[model samples]
Target chain A: MTTPPPHRPVPQPTQRVVVTSPRTRAPRARRPYSGTREINEQSELGAVYMRTLIRAQRRLGLSVCLVTTGVLALLPLLFSLEPALGRFRVFGLGLPWFLLCVATFPMLLLAGWFYVRQAERSEREFAELVERP
Target chain B: MTSGYAVVAVLVVVLGTILVGAYGLRVSRTTSDFYVASRTVSPWWNASAIGGEYLSAASFVGIAGLIFAYGPDMLWFPVGYTAGYLVLLTMVAAPLRRSGAYTLPDFAEARFRSRAVRGVASVLALAIGWLYLLPQLEGAGLTLNTVTGAPDWVGALIVMVVVTVNVMSGGMRSITFVQAFQYWLKLTAITVPIVFLVVVWQVHGAESLTAPEYPAFRQDTEVTFNNDTMIHAERSLAIRGTGEVDGVRVDGGFVLTDGYHRIGQGSEFTFPKDATVPHLSTMAHNTNESWALPESSGADFPLYGAYSLIIATFLGTMGLPHVIVRFYTNPNGTAARRTTLILLGLLSVFYLMPPVYGALGRLYTPELLMTGQTDAVVLVLPARVVDGIGGELLGALVAGGAFAAFLSTSSGLVVSLAGVLSQDVLRLGGVRGFRISAVLAGVVPLAMTFVSTGMPVADMVGLAFAVAASSLCPLLMLGIWSSRTTTVGAIAGMLAGGVPALTAGLVTMFTDTGDAWYEVLLSRPAAWTVPLGFTVMYVVSLLTQRHVPPGVQRTMVKLHAPENLGLDGSGPGSGDERS
Candidate 1:
């Protein structure tokens, strides 16, 4: 085998350093910074990035959806399995009414809030990775 | 009801919409502005606009009516409707925005590189748009007839003309602001009335509204049948009124036996307090408890129907042409996702108000059950519950809100339908072509309003959702996620899913059927059709792997990639990297 090429160390900038030179290093060619943009330019990189993002999103989405749909589906089953459940009331509102009408909104909102927070977090992580040298 | 106040309210909304459109026209100088407001709509504003357009007469008037007629089970309508956005936000919103296509058909053509797929998508969009539009027109007619006693067609005609004019004048730019404004207006109109009505209910002594008995008129009530009505009396009904009953002219004090009785057009029936309210013959055949209990409502296959409705509304929202088009207004994928998040809140708040109206309607406006015009319960409740000028004012507010709902949603649908019609079918371009398409879009649905009768507004909207869910939901999901989706597979999936759903929708719309399994199957096709669509697409795509679009890899990257990445996301194989 031929001799291997030498590895070059990546330049690491220190936070404390403040270079005030007017035109140091020819402005560094204005490289694209966004991770998404980097992936967009490189098809192989893009494929990996997309797979990760989609997988995370789909996993989170499916979990939330399954939970929500489970509750909704179980409601009728609960009623059928235990007829007395329908008669069960909280604050004079029937259990089904209270659950389906009044309670469902907050639950759905919470689910949405959870989803948005998680999704944005995933994006932020991806963005940070893309920004790293 | 005071026709003058209601008419004034309606005129204010119509004129306001027109003025807004004219203003948008003045500002919209570029084609980009007309198509997507230069893709600069903020999340909150776009969310509100989406909420405005999404909460059509179905949500505004029909949900309340359904709850009143069918009880607690109908609560699913609002729940399903609101949750639909959650589904959209999770699965489709970001990718769809990143696709950067102006319409659903555009997305299809871009994804599959198949004009045939685009053609089918265009037809489905038009069909779904029109199907959705029919209800807004019908609701307008119903509202006008109830509030002003105008002939049914006049209200539909007015709405059609106004929507067409607005769309032709300014396209989507004007509609964005108008719809966003209308969302707040609608929320206030609905919420304010409910606050007063609920206070009134409490002050009048909040009696147990959940007594397990059929509804009884709380006070003396007069019901006018605008069209011929068949009422099923559980007990003999003694009425003092004038007009024709069962083809006999009764001056006063007519008795309807415990059976079906026909009340002719213009017939008026006055019922005494505490009398059991007669049920509409159309709906009375089913067993429903007075308290609108969940399982006791005697819906045929309630579980199946409920699950199907959930499937349709949840999966179906992303496929609505008007709704999907709004996603294109977002500046980027992030904004699109943010808009959906905000929309969930807006829609949840708005949905909360309708159930209050529905519950109050059941308490105070039981006579609607007899007229089978339960959908008008939301309009009539404010006047019935509140007293004097305040009542009239609240009634007018509700009227204004209802008109706004009709106008905003119908206008959105018309804009979307016109856009597709102009681009695909008419093969026309520019503003003038859009104008002609606008007229075509509005007139056909307006004509449908006259031909169809007796179908509840929400049910009609549901059929539209089913069709959308069956066809476009599969197309959108698979197109974005799966690179192996071939053009043949896409076409096959759409036909397998859409045709059956469409046929079912058409059959349900045009024909009346007894309580049969086939009828239920046709009426609620989403449960099966959606699955059928996915299965066909998946299996066919697997079999025809060789025919997969050559550029799907790049397209997938563009769709899932962040907009900041600067990939060429315009279409497949056009990967011009923007620095």
Candidate 2:
């Protein structure tokens, strides 16, 4: 409208204003993926929580393993001595009854429960770790 | 009276299993399906299939036979076999499922990136498969010859044909269904007859048990050597008299006499000279005997041996070519874990039954131990205690179940071998190459069966475990847990561990050392070989750690991370996901 020259206001190359001064450069160098690296580092905080969970799970498993081994060692002796035990029954059962019922079946169930729960927990923790912000 | 019924039954079970397996084949379009049914199998189904495959001919006939011949000590086989699964569940099952490999050879290649290691694994898998297959074929021959008087070769041929048909048609998917169904059949066959036989025994009571003679003069149970010679060992038994041993009567038995007490279904016995030797040539007792208390040595050995054997079996289960392939059928690692747990349950329950059989054998078939028919113990049980129709029906059911066991396990092993073979060797060509490779894989074993002499099936299975424990077990455990494992270490460990286990097992098969120390070493090689494998892997890994590959850290993260985390995700303290 005012008959400006061909390019009209070729804006002065905006004063080359720089946030970082030449004399005092930034303390941290710019990483290739600054955003992603920051996010990953932040998410690592969750690792401690996950580690605790995993440690507890492993402790639980080791405890059970030791107990089960002890029980298995004792079973053969007890079952062998059943005839000499004088009609003794743990709960309304004979020597065979105690072995099959109280000992074998129950122990198997408990072990199975432990495995299922631990597997699930481990998987859940893994998923949580992956999905973290 | 109908001779053709047994043959027909064999055909129906074989064909039916194949047809069902074919139905499963429709869903198998990818490599995953061919190798592991895409990993979606539920635990119940997987457990059943595992049960089906786990119960080999040895479990069916040999176990009962052993129980019949020996006393309760023979129960160790089943107990150890099942307990191995528990060890697997706790230690290696989930980790192996996460390995994402198709076969043991595949795992070897991935862990060490060494063709040499893989070659060793492939050869071992093939050898063990073939060695195990021999007993199965022999069992089929024995069953056919014993039950229907068919030629032994015919029985072997029939099994080979049926197994080939099922395996070739469906691969892993098809076999999965076949094995699951077979497990149920096996359970029913065993349990139903036992119930009926017990009822018959209780009803018939003590009368049918004929007392031969009190304190029949002591007899030595002797084993034949090369059919031309004999070996004798002194044995003492509390003579229950010449009672009905498997529906047969003895001449004298209130007391033990120096002779083979119980012969065949229609046979008699007389005291023979050289009482230190088992039944003399003319006398019928060709089996051995010992005081019952002395024989139940399941507790006698050091616990270390027991624990080591259990660990070997448990760790070895994950490495078994046939068993590991089953996990490939599952949809994810979670399902694989569940499947393992279900397997544990099935194994535990089924295993309980074996000890009962062994205990019962102490009362019935002590001679089985002497004759080394421990594998046939399960098959002969019903007939011995139950009479007439019930026993026949039970026997038939057990036959079907035993056939299932042999077929499922053999097919699984063959498929694993074939998978590795086709991938590595046959890949040079195409589909035609694959077919040829399959045939070659099977034919070698079939030939080997003809050449192999007889051995106990349980012992053969145990040797397989020992081999697996020494080689594949260490590779897997270290590959999953240790960061420094190098290709060289793996190869060295595999060779060092594998050679000893195989050598000892084979030696035990061909030679019988009179010395107890020599006998124990030949029978149990795991005690030495497992540690040797671990040591080799660790030493080699440490030496090679400086040249660790770039992807190791990432792979470690993936391996150690939780399931929900995408494998691509960065671990804690990892600055960049890509790095």
Evaluate every candidate with DockQ and list the scores. Answer: 0.16, 0.08
In terms of lDDT, the poorest run of 10 residues in model 1 chain B is B570-579
- Model 1 achieves a DockQ score of 0.16
Per-model TM values vs. the true structure: 0.92, 0.76
Native contacts matched by each model = 0.31, 0.15
- lDDT by residue (B104-191, candidate 2, tens digit) is 7776665555677788878777666665666777787767664576656776777777777666666677777788988888777667
Docking class of 1: incorrect
What interface-residue Cα RMSD does candidate 1 give after superposition?
Answer: 14.1
Cα displacement (Å) at residue A24, model 1? 31
For B1-579, candidate 1 gives per-residue lDDT tens digits of: 546788889999989999999999998754555676766688999999999999899999999998878877778889989888888887889889878677899889879888899999999999999999999999999899888988888889999999899888887888999999999999999999998998999999986677666778888888788778888888887889998988999888988788888889989879888877888876743333445567555667777787788889988998999999999888777788889989999998999888777777777898888888889999999988999889988999999999999999999999899889988999777677778999999999987876775688999999999989999999998888777899989989988899899899988887777677678788888899999998998899899999898777678776875555444434423333332
Candidate 1 wrongly placed segments (more than 4 Å):
A1-30, A33-46, B284-290, B569-577
Candidate 2 residue-wise lDDT, A26-131, digit = tens: 1222222433333334345434544454455456555665576557655445545453452454554344334532365557557757876876776565455444
lDDT of 2 at B289: 27
